[model samples]
Target: MTQRFLRVAIALVCLTATTAWNDASSAVAETTLGIGDKAPALDIEHYIHEDNGFGKVEKFEDGKVYIVEFWATWCGPCIQSMPHLVELQNKYRGEGVQIVSISDEDLETVQELMEQEYPGKEETFAEVTNAYTLTVDPDGSTTEDYMRAAGRNGIPASFLVGKTGLIEWIGHPMELDEPLADVLADRWDREAYKEQMKRQEQFQIAMQKVNQLAGSGKFEDALKVVKKVLEDMEGADDPRSNLIREQLTAFQYNLRLDSGDRSEEVMTFFRDQLAEAKKDARELTQFSYNMMASMQQGTDLGPLAGETIAALKDAVGTADEEVMPIMYVLIAQMNASMSNFDEAIANQKKAVETSTGRTKERMEQMLEQFEKMAAEEADGDQDAEGDKAAEKVDAAK
Candidate 1:
């Protein structure tokens, strides 16, 4: 990774301790599901049908080593990994390894892709489905359940369930062969497996609460829930918590902005959020600039000007090319709001100089507008002086 990326990683590591958002540690503890965790109960519906080469198609049964893989047809990685999964199915066929690929997509969407791949060969499709279960999750229940156990950042995430009806491993299908071999050999760590299952179960409960709060638009409440969940994780840092923390911070910022109250209470609340968000480099540098710009436009500088400028200067020093220009624009706007005209002009000039495309154009327009507003104020002042002079002459006469 680049130096900038290294810095960001360090920042996230440090911030993880301070953040009280989603805690995968607690989820892990509660579910006790990990590398060696027993796979939780998973009864994925078999939605597709396929006929056999010699005769009729077959259906699937539960309580087997079902390799329930979460994938999407549209996902490139998922597509790339499908063939490997097919190979695994051929290799592990009747030995009790059930490979199931399920999508949250509709039947029509999945059927279209399958038809394109197999043409008029419904028999082949049915055989494939029975051998390697391909199904859809309509209400997202199965997806939710699995996500709680193993939070997938993207598609092509697979879970290896043992014949004892426990999740053996959760990772990419490409990595499944080694774990599969181990499970087949009966050379697995049973203790670690049980602990991982516990963690997965905990994560499931935490995620359920998180989803419900998010669905209800109770973002603040969701944040609270996430904090409690993370606390339960007992300081264990996981990618899921990090992702949720990033999202929750942005959601909080948006909620504060959209409230439209503008009272001291509101301003103080937003200012505190901006202060707390510094640890999360992603949210601090990315969304905070947007918040700062909005504050400048709204003229709500109860206490954010100095705080924003300081934070932005730090961001400008550390931010990559992608975020640097925005930092410049936000600092310039904050300077302008503070009436530090020279500093404002310098920062705005830098914003225009370093930026390109639509951003540069926008900065340039802001400079022009600031100049016009200043000139108009100057003209008004001169007219007022002329009136004062006329009043003095009248008094002397």
Candidate 2:
């Protein structure tokens, strides 16, 4: 995907984590179902493993609470949350709670992954996830019944089903503890949760508008919306606010740079942001990468290229080991764009040396390409010299 599309996708997905849910009536209008709605019945086609003293629970039973989680093996967050789910299962097993982890991947793929050894742990996936029930939905009936029915579009989604077989809460797996406890104790305040959902609905609507404006290349209009959000959002120091501010600044800089409004002023604006972003390695790396990608997309940085190189060098000084290799690769690309072949080769070598795996292999390939270009340039110069000498001899004759 293009960088712009990718950024918007990430923003939309992450906004859900920060926003609250809508009221039941409004949520039902917005989605197929909402909290307090009866959950669809379990549609497990087959069970891979049913441990934890609970075997093949084909349906939600009375006097029992269920944590029905949808996940996949390729999801990093899903894998990380496995241990937490295990802990929850162990803690609530006596309280009549069962955690079921469901995946839609093929049985062979799931089996291989379950049997394969993971780094830092010798336990198979089956052994590691022995505390909870494991199942595969080849027909996707379970996912359609739960995730699609609830209007959830992403993975690692969780539903806390109460004793009455109603969805008490729906959110990320990590956000399940408090709601689970409340549902177990019969103290969940449905009204309050509904109000929170309403607020979340508002946030979601606003974010969609902002994303649409930005996607349409209306950066100035988008900046206005961003400013409005920053001013109106409740918490000034909220991470979401900070993130939007960063985006606003970046948009403003791009707008100025694109318009050619004030060359020196745009450079100053970018340099100031670079200085502030350098303190955070992740932000610095991301900013630098975006800049590099923008240049590659044909946005000429001109004199700003030197400034960007300098800023990248400064970022490198404070960047952690993980980010260093990427920064080096960006620096090498910048130098190559300026026809500084030797410098490009040197920086690329450093990147290759510092990186490993696919990254190292890719860098090695780039290094070879750069070496070939340099040799071609040398040969062209030699050809020019020979032509000039021939001309001199012809004039003498």
Q: How accurate locally, in lDDT, is each candidate?
A: 0.58, 0.69
lDDT of 1 by residue, 242-282 (tens): 55445445545454544344576667776777777676555
Worst 10 residues of 2 by lDDT: 16-25
In model 2, pairs of residues that clash are 21-197, 21-198, 22-197, 22-198
Roughly what TM-score does model 2 have, to 2 decimal places?
A: 0.61
* TM-score of each prediction: 0.38, 0.61
**lDDT digits (tens) for residues 1-397 of candidate 2:** 2233323323322221112122111222247767888878787876777545888777789989999998876554576577788889999989999888889988887887787554235677778788888888878888887877776766688888899988888877887888899989999886667655555555555556765675576657866775676566645453334544565556667755654444777888877877777777666656666566555444677766777788778777666555676677778766765567798789878878875443466667767766776677678889999999999999999
Q: CA RMSD for every model? A: 14.3, 8.0
Clash number for every model? 28, 4
- Which residue segments of model 1 deviate by more than 4 Å? 1-40, 43-46, 52-64, 118-131, 192-397
